[model samples]
Target: MATPPSLSPISPPSPPNTTTTAPPSSLPNNTAPPTPPVTNNSDPVADSPNGTFANLLPPPPPPRSVESLPPGTLAGLIVGVGLGALIVLIGAGIFVIFYRRRKKKLANNYSGAAPQGVDPQHWQQSVPQITVLPKPTPPPGITPHLYNSVEPPSTSTSLGSEKPSNASPSPVVAMGHSLGTFTYEDLAMATDNFTDSNLIGQGGFGYVHKGVLKDGKVVAIKQLKVGSGQGEREFQAEVDIISRVHHRHLVSLVGYCIVGVQRLLVYDFVPNDTLEFHLHGKDRPVMNWSTRMKIALGAAKGLAYLHEDCKPKIIHRDIKAANILLDESFEARLADFGLAKYSLDTDTHVSTRVMGTFGYMAPEYASSGKLTEKSDVFSFGVVLLEMITGYRPVDKIQRSLMIA
Candidate 1:
């Protein structure tokens, strides 16, 4: 075999000269010295005993490809995944907490406080607690009595002979349930003998006066005009309808009085005046768009409750602007249920005498005396027109008149 040529040792090339600078006195001299750079003579082929050309080049740059990750890289990936999972878990926990709190608040609003004077034992007993009605579902298995042919209770039995002036009038139990009752004396005293200053409003049937009961509760006392022809029927009808139904949008019946021939209805006093007053009263500030929209929505909801929720749905025979009263918060409530009539599920239209404000009556109801939920809708439309145009239903000056 021929002898291989001897390889000569190679010298490293000199580095280019750079100006050296001294550290400033303010800096410390504990810094480590710079590392010397490897030269061509430092090849693995020259250093190793079994050297080959394969070892001459650098050791393949320690495999920088993704497949060969560094030790620290794997640790960093695991730490990053753990941190992301922790963040997601924390976010989920926060969302669940907020949702539960909001749900509880809504439940409280829908379930209002029990009415004053409700017997605790009776409230806790089998009688189901009255909550804001979401829809009118009749009491389970209970037949709703129709008032279509209900005649006025005879004078002898209706209000019963007036109790002697010396004796306190006995409380009258409601037909289906126990409700508060007032004597003529009790209400007369509350209203200061129905002075003109106590009068809040007047309607075809009666005058409404603000009164304060002995229990410190404010009430609206509606004294029906004697011999109004329908006073007796209206009293019974209103009691039957409002006693069994409870809704946030409807005026709550506090109690009723039938002393001798005088008839009166007590209701929870709504602090604000009628929608008519705000909409048409002179020198009153214009109702803003938001407030007007709120009123409209609330009134629609009230009618919806009567038409869609009640078992034998009710048709608000009178849905004029005057009947829509507002509370201190400007919440709209449907008042005056004296003319409200029930429409049985089996009946297409209740055959009743036409009764409503002059210009707010529906044409079909006025001409045919046929009553249905549509009758109320027609009146509601007229009220909506009034709200939009800011005009009375019967504006004699404008020559604008709307019936039903």
Candidate 2:
């Protein structure tokens, strides 16, 4: 009977996985609400609408457009992006500039010692301590003027008697001549390579030439060729001796040029020729009596300047008519200092090698070579005689010496 009940009461099982939802547990009480009464006033469709007609109330004003946001939003976003990129670029640029400046500054920095606060471009000179030296001392025979220059006394070296007498001459050249300097190129260009056409005169030590400078300034150039004639030291001596000597009657050395082996002296060019040309040339006028007297006085003044005014008495051993240069105004000047001899080196006369022209030399200097201030006086007398008589000293001496 049980078996038969199972078969009879069996129903198909629910599908395997399907789920069904149940209503809420809190169910409302079983009560009926009264329906509202519908009053018939006019056609329903005309009075009020429902369903699709009610839904068509302009579709709820079509939802607002998202792109129509407030004014600042999109602009703010774009500016923010641009500002961010600018900040990144600026940061990178600043970093690069800092590194480059630091690198360049370090590269330019120098560690070597230099003068304090000196720019190295201006006052950059430095005086190192170790480079200083003691002043030099003079050796024997260097101070030749203190005693006889040629023959030192037998006891002089042994005794070393350094004391001097009261009447010692100063070493200074006295009132000094105003001197000028010229560029070496000026002389070369002026003389046109020391041409023969420009040659005006010649001497034992040098040659003279007339020249015109680039500025149209006329000048005379005395080229001193390099040799051991007076020795290389003579060139320096000539400049030193002449620079310190000044007299109205003496020719003024205006400028000089020295380039290696070439040495040139510059003088104010005299427009007129030498006195010898006028005295000897037939075409030229003979010098007047007053002119000759002035010339003699000028020569005496030049000699007086050399002998009395200067510290060391200088004797122009070769004074002659050829050496007397004249200007356009006939003003006289004593020229040719290349053969000048000086003495009174110490407290007394310091004699060395005896040298002079034949006719103008003193009798004492010519024979024994023992010269003094008196020797120059004798030579001056000879020149005076020559000027007064208008006769050459050589001719007179030749005539007199042949008398025996």
Candidate 3:
């Protein structure tokens, strides 16, 4: 009987008419329900049984595209991109302009062209140019004016007693060789009335003070002691010789001032102190070997220039260490031409009054006052000895020995 029942239920299996769909909870929030693809088979059951299921689904969102965005949204995006591009272009332009301006400013601050016959690399430190002003006319019988606050002595004792024949009310001279002539009042303002605080150096010639002109130029002003006929002659000689000479190793003569008997010479300021100061100054570090060599070479070149290159040649009567000044780069500049002499071509030697530092004086010059280029060379040799041994030419130890 069980077998007969099983046979009765063996009818053809009906085709599955319905498909099951996943619950809405099973899909991600951002994911759309996947649509069943349309097929060519005309099976009613395979498609949705009623149009209700298709209606519940959105009309497959009108195929999304960029053109479908709102007008306002598209315009905002275009404007934002354009503004970003413009800002970048403006920043680039500004940087270029600033770079060019900085480059031009540096070029403008550069000093004058390098001196002739000098190594450009060695002469990197630029020497500022001195602006030579026009010579001014002077009043007759010009009364000398003191540039400092110190009260002038009575007319009888003042430098007026030794006034030069060419002296005039105007400091400027008509001579072609004269440099820029400064008024006594102008120099007084520059040197702070030649106060003791402004003194930079002191020597047999006079006292040197630092001065700054109205135009922002720095200079060394040497004021010769009054009532010394020798000093007056030295002043005249220095002005005449230095005004005509120009070389890289020589101290440049910027200008000169002659008020009454007061004689002052203006020279380019050497920032670094004199060789003597560096070598023997209290509280100063000992100069390194390299710097000493540089100074020696530069001084030699300067001395050679004076003896060989100058017209009729020159004799630096005082070639002591104190007369060798240094610049920012420690370039030696031969200064203090007060004792310099012009050697005549026809004369073998110049017989002059004994002058020069005692220890640095040559034997011939000290004995017979016979000055020559060789005398300068001899003094230079003593300076070389000082540099090598770091010994003062006339120290207390040497003086004691001489006394004994």
Candidate 4:
């Protein structure tokens, strides 16, 4: 061999096997850690004491149910639910009680019940009076008391005696004497289909048409304006109030017709026109002083009757020359009860909506809606100024007739 390099390669000697002991500080003091047992890849058995996984997982948690709840917790939940139900029931009961009380109070107010501190007996015994200046001498042939001779019709011929009609009676009839009820068709025929030719007047509430009924009785039919915000209730209230009142100086309600939303009131027709026509109309003779005084007195008497004679006093809210209707004999008749209001005898002032002609309205009533009998009296005084001065209460140059 050593004679020539051997063609075969020789492997390097492997390092001699060496064993070195670790330092005491670096080595663990206890015995060597035990090796973990290897799990068999193909084994289906569970590694549990009883050869099942049930023990490995905590014994399956107890089934979830309300029964698992603690005794005190269950009782508290029941008590909470009961308390909530009780509270709801109590609130509903209180609401119903308050609602009933408020409704009853409103009804009493609307029905004009006697107010607190008012003695009904004492009020009945007393005669209410409207203070007035002494009256001037009346013109010849005209009686001093214009309406004294006129008597209310007997009960036999009153509205209560009217035969029942096909149309149902309005609730307004119950408040006063029963009134005749007419269908819309009956009224249409009487007024020739509400033609302009038959139109007698127009005002805030509606148009007035002259008509002749089948019974040959002449009447003034008032057709309330559509979309005027006036409804069956308001119309019924007006009819109820006016029907109960009967006076020679006051307009009378003959009957009323209701068709759907349409409301028509029938009244006895006055032969002559309104007092405004005679006082301020063109081509009219000027009213003399004595005639003016007579008119003033008559109107005052009517107002006084409304304010004093009525059980629940009526306030003629709108008082103006235009509202005064004249008869053939020039006797004054107060018409248009649309804006009338009822006032309690014990009330100092009735709070209401500010209504009435501009110049005729009292300053106190116009500024504040507190109305009283005195408010009507103030309007009457304005009318007196109009009669005396022969000028309009409100005019282009003078907005209001100021007292000197």
**Residue-wise lDDT of candidate 2 within 1-404, one digit each (tens)?**
45553456668997667364554566558744445557777644464545554555454576677567577897998999999999999999999999999776544332212223323322111111111112222222233122110111111211123111222222221211234555555676788867899999886667889899888989988877654446233444445445445566777666555433445678878778876676665677666789888877777777777676554466666666777788877777887676565555453553545776677777777787666766667766776676666666666545654110
Q: Where is model 1 poorest over a 10-residue stretch in terms of lDDT?
A: 157-166
Q: Please provide, for model 3 over 18-137, each residue's C-alpha lDDT reduced to its tens digit, 9 standing for 90 to 100.
A: 686656667787898888766666543347677655676555557666667898999999999999999999999999999999777556425422234434432232222333343333
CA deviation > 4 Å runs, candidate 4? 1-176, 231-234, 397-404
When summed lDDT is taken over every stretch of 10 residues in candidate 3, the lowest stretch is: 150-159
Cα misplacement distance, residue 304 of candidate 2 (Å): 0.6
Compared with the true structure, model 1 gives a TM-score of: 0.58
Q: How far is candidate 1 from the true structure (C-alpha RMSD, Å)?
A: 24.0
Count of clashes, each model: 6, 3, 0, 0
The candidate that wins on lDDT is: 3
Model 2 scores a C-alpha lDDT of 0.58
- The reply for model 1, stretches above 4 Å from the true place, is 1-176, 400-404
Q: Report the poorest 10 consecutive residues by lDDT, candidate 2.
A: 146-155
Question: What are the per-residue Cα lDDT tens digits for candidate 4 across 52-84?
Answer: 655344554777876578989999999999999
Q: What's the lDDT for residue 351 in model 2?
A: 55
Provide the overall lDDT of each model, using Cα atoms, as 2-decimal numbers: 0.71, 0.58, 0.73, 0.68
Estimate the TM-score of every prediction: 0.58, 0.51, 0.58, 0.56
Can you rank all candidates by TM-score, best first?
3, 1, 4, 2
